[model samples]
Target: MSTPLDIASLIDRERIRPFQWTIFLLCFATTLFDGFDTQAIAYTGPAIVAAFNLAPGDLAPILIAGTLGMTIGAMTLGLVGDRVGRRPALLGGVALFSIASLATAFASGTSQILVLRFIAGLGMGGCTPVLLALAAEYGPARHRGAIMTGVLLGLPAGAMLGGLLAARMMPVIGWEGVFVIGGAAPLALLVLLWFALPESLHFLVTRAGNDQHAVRHVLARIVTWPLADDARFAVHEAAARASVAALFREGNARNTVAIWAVYFFNWIAWFMFLSWLPTVLKASGLPAAQAPLGTVVVNAVFIVCAIPLSIALPRISTRRLLIALLALGIAIAIGLAYAETSWGLVFTLAGAAGLGIGGQQIALNYLVVGAYPTTLRATATGWAIGMGRVGAIAGSAVGGTFLNMGGPGGFYLTLAVPLAAALLAVIAIRTNEPEAGTSLATAAH
Candidate 1:
């Protein structure tokens, strides 16, 4: 029951004096744009269909390809980030995605477009985990929760931008113009990230030796404490010492597996709702015009939850927060099945589901990363992300199959099976103190 973890002192935001707020803001903006460009295609789907003369079912491959690409990028660049540092990983991922967007503008066929999208996805995937690591490493300790909020809030904002641009820009430049802008804009910012964003001080102290000039500069600016000793740390060597097998080395393996399991189900439930809800709403008596608006409302609710979740997370036990959100998600799925009316009950359930989804996502990420030590942070995050993507793909792909068979009610009710699994999984994540030698891959804890 007694753990030496100085979490309270470690996380003091007032003491987070080294990293500049401006730098954190920059990282947040970069991720926001990444989310926007990635989702822009979904907004342009109607136009892309008209231009390419494609069918509803025909676009699935493109979506799948992109998702798969992102999955690979997350795994690959995640390891690369640990070895080479987050800055290069961030820059490379952004550059790759930007070029893919440009290539999409000249897509000559469905196959070409699909390939381009997949490449773009690889970039997007690479950006997220590293950006998260970057944010965690560079931001003030106490402000990590709020900083995550500022960084991730860019997503909904980006989605809104995509929606606005699709409404405005597509008319003038067409879908091709949209892709051109998506590709070109990030490429432009690539120059700015290179010059303005300094490597994380924690990262530099660990990997680059005691470069007092850089370390002292960043430390004095970012952290509130003025320690007389300036010791350089090596994150890569520490990371190299961590093996996949180490995740289970302590009794903590079970907890690690528990986190993965909950994430697995949460992702499935969320993506399933995203891909099928609008279509199901239309089928269940709502007008086609109003169906997609369900997504907008859900997203709006998600945006509202972002700040509250941040405010709540560090104040609560991570495992407890994870389980509560998962339970809420399960209840929302069932509630959605019964709220069949134009009275907006369905929209309310959708919004609540959005809240659960957003909360669970943030909690899961924080829990997984914080649960692990510095060396294996990205790998732990990568596996959790990779597992979640499997659910996302299943949700998006299989929801279509469900809709073809029954309707919205059956379509949503079926997803409750996965939510149930997620609930059970999170319930298994017990509160325990962190162990120094615990590997994150095990499930015994």
Candidate 2:
């Protein structure tokens, strides 16, 4: 009788292969486009305001609409990923966003823009957690943290790229052209994903109803050893039924709740900064032409720090690292509250804030992906992100309100509260180390 082969151990024991790198690159590309489209509206906000003859504050509803859709998408498609497969769920998300973004180019008014952005958000929200799940599963156990972080870097990189493109493209092609580019790139990427993306091997073996032959074929590509026709395959990790409830099972409840809290509070500060910083900078006497660059600074700094942080994650304590990063964000928020409105001072603070906020966001995502088993990974990550999107909705709305009520000082000061809460939430989490695929037997006991 053939013995059962553990899929996770099989990957851990092998050298990194080209097949894995291809998956990483594909995931990176998907996230890159997701970032571009997600932030496209922000970059194009001023132009949209001008085009529609609307007040700056009117953008809040549009922002909220998108995030609300993202919340729904994250929760819904995340479950879909667990039920069907990560590849199909990811592809569906990309297709949804691509089509929505293309439609945004032709939008005639705020209502239409709101609708299009919401639809685009659905795709954005849905694909993100699934992509992270796929990337983490494909990555080796020893380097999973770094690999996941590298894949996630595409988000900020894409956003930074959007900022650069918007600065140049908006001048020549207008906001419509920016949307057109945003929509088109992902549509092209969608085609590539449909053809090139592979299903997660973890999912193939662990999930019911998958073809055994297909699993063997994928396994053969990753490993040099030949598999017998009757060789049994398994993922040693605890299996949960394909449902959201699985997130709370197998000693995951507290970790799940804490993760959601961290995501919720962190995103309140994160999206508030992302959604309003450009406009806030403009209001604080920065040039209209340069306001969007503030966001670029944040994302650029984030991209710069990602690799080093990723490299450090496995070597350090994740909980302590997360808490320290949140503390840094709190400090930056306080600094921003008192800093003068000069571009030099504000931009300097923005970069520092990126280090704190961006680092925490990436690390938290890494933690979530690593904390749960393969069965619950996508759902847990998605729900956490979905909760964060809800916070993002609040952040967008609160940003406008705060700006109108007390200006930049009040807005920046308020951010510190959420960062502090997130710090506490991080402290509350019980599972802070990389799980690296705990065995079912180990987990149960």
Candidate 3:
């Protein structure tokens, strides 16, 4: 008689293997480049404006194009991952962005830049949810939250790298050189992914065209076991077809709506701060050269704190932690409005706020990925991130208006509204338990 093996149990039971680490690292690298390219336009924005002799508002279309593309890509390509495969979807997205970034270097007009950026956004946006799903699937349940957050940390790290490279390389080779490097690095990574990146074992088994041979090969590497030709593999989760409506079925409706709400409002506050903080800092008496440091401090603090936060995620309730983080952000936003013009005070407050908002964003990823079955993981994560991208667009669009109406104090005060709403949404989530080691199969049913 052939022996039956549960794929989820096999992954959960094994010690962390080198193969799994490789997957995590690759996913991390992908996100790192994703961040770099995503922010490439921002880093190059001034250069583009100067190069083209364009009006101030002319760049808005170029900026918004990429984000708009990302929103659509996340919602649609995420479904592609569910139906086709993670490996292919990821490869395709990387290819799309790489080519787009490379092409951006050759653009002659603002129109060309706008279209190329939108195309690049599609790839970057699609990759986020798929990579998250891929990394989470490979990770052992005990360490899943840490692995996902670790991968996500690359976004900020890459953004920081883009800033450094833009400062250094633009001086040497000019702005076009920045895009050239961004496009080339990922093209190199694409070759490695083709050779080394494996399709998700869970995806292989659960997908309609089950590829048992591929599953056995990947399983052997992870488990280091010899398997019989007659051996059978299965996932313990309840059957779920990959579809948008499936997100609302199977008792998932409440969690889905709440997760979407949290993502939407949290990003509204986040992008608002990211978009306008430098201007706000400058207006509050800081020099233009030093103003950008406030944003850097925020990202750096979050990157540093991510380590301990990841450690604590498995031990505590993600829901409660997220709520606390949002509350902290709310308080900090209010405090920021009343803070003195001292640079030290402003940077300090910004860092503290980054800890709260940035930490909450990662915790939301941990919560959402664990809430769905293997079949719907990519789709669910994709849609939530897509919704967040929409919120980002909204925040970025309205930030100028807020600054005009309220100045620094008003801008900061307005930020608190979104954080408060996000806190309420998180509080409404009914699944309050730590998701580690729990079978989502049972939870879904």
Clashes of each: 24, 0, 0
Task: Please report the candidate that would top TM-score against the real structure.
Answer: 2
Q: Give all TM-scores, in the order shown.
A: 0.77, 0.85, 0.81
Candidate 3 wrong stretches, greater than 4 Å: 49-58, 206-209, 241-260, 276-295, 314-324, 334-341, 365-386, 404-410, 424-445
List runs of model 2 lying over 4 Å from the truth.
Answer: 202-208, 229-232, 241-262, 314-323, 365-386, 421-445
Model 3, residue 162: C-alpha shift (Å): 1.7
Q: Model 3: per-residue lDDT, tens digit, 129-189? A: 7898888888777677667778988987877677667655675767788899889999999
Put down candidate 2 lDDT per residue, 285-380, tens digits, no spaces.
776666678879999998888777766765566788888899999999998988857667788989988888767775765676457766676567
How far in Å is the alpha carbon of 416 misplaced in model 2?
2.8
TM-score of 1: 0.77
Q: Can you give the lDDT of residue 255 in candidate 3?
A: 81
All models: lDDT? 0.69, 0.81, 0.79
Candidate 3 clashes between residue pairs 3 or more apart in a chain or in different chains: none
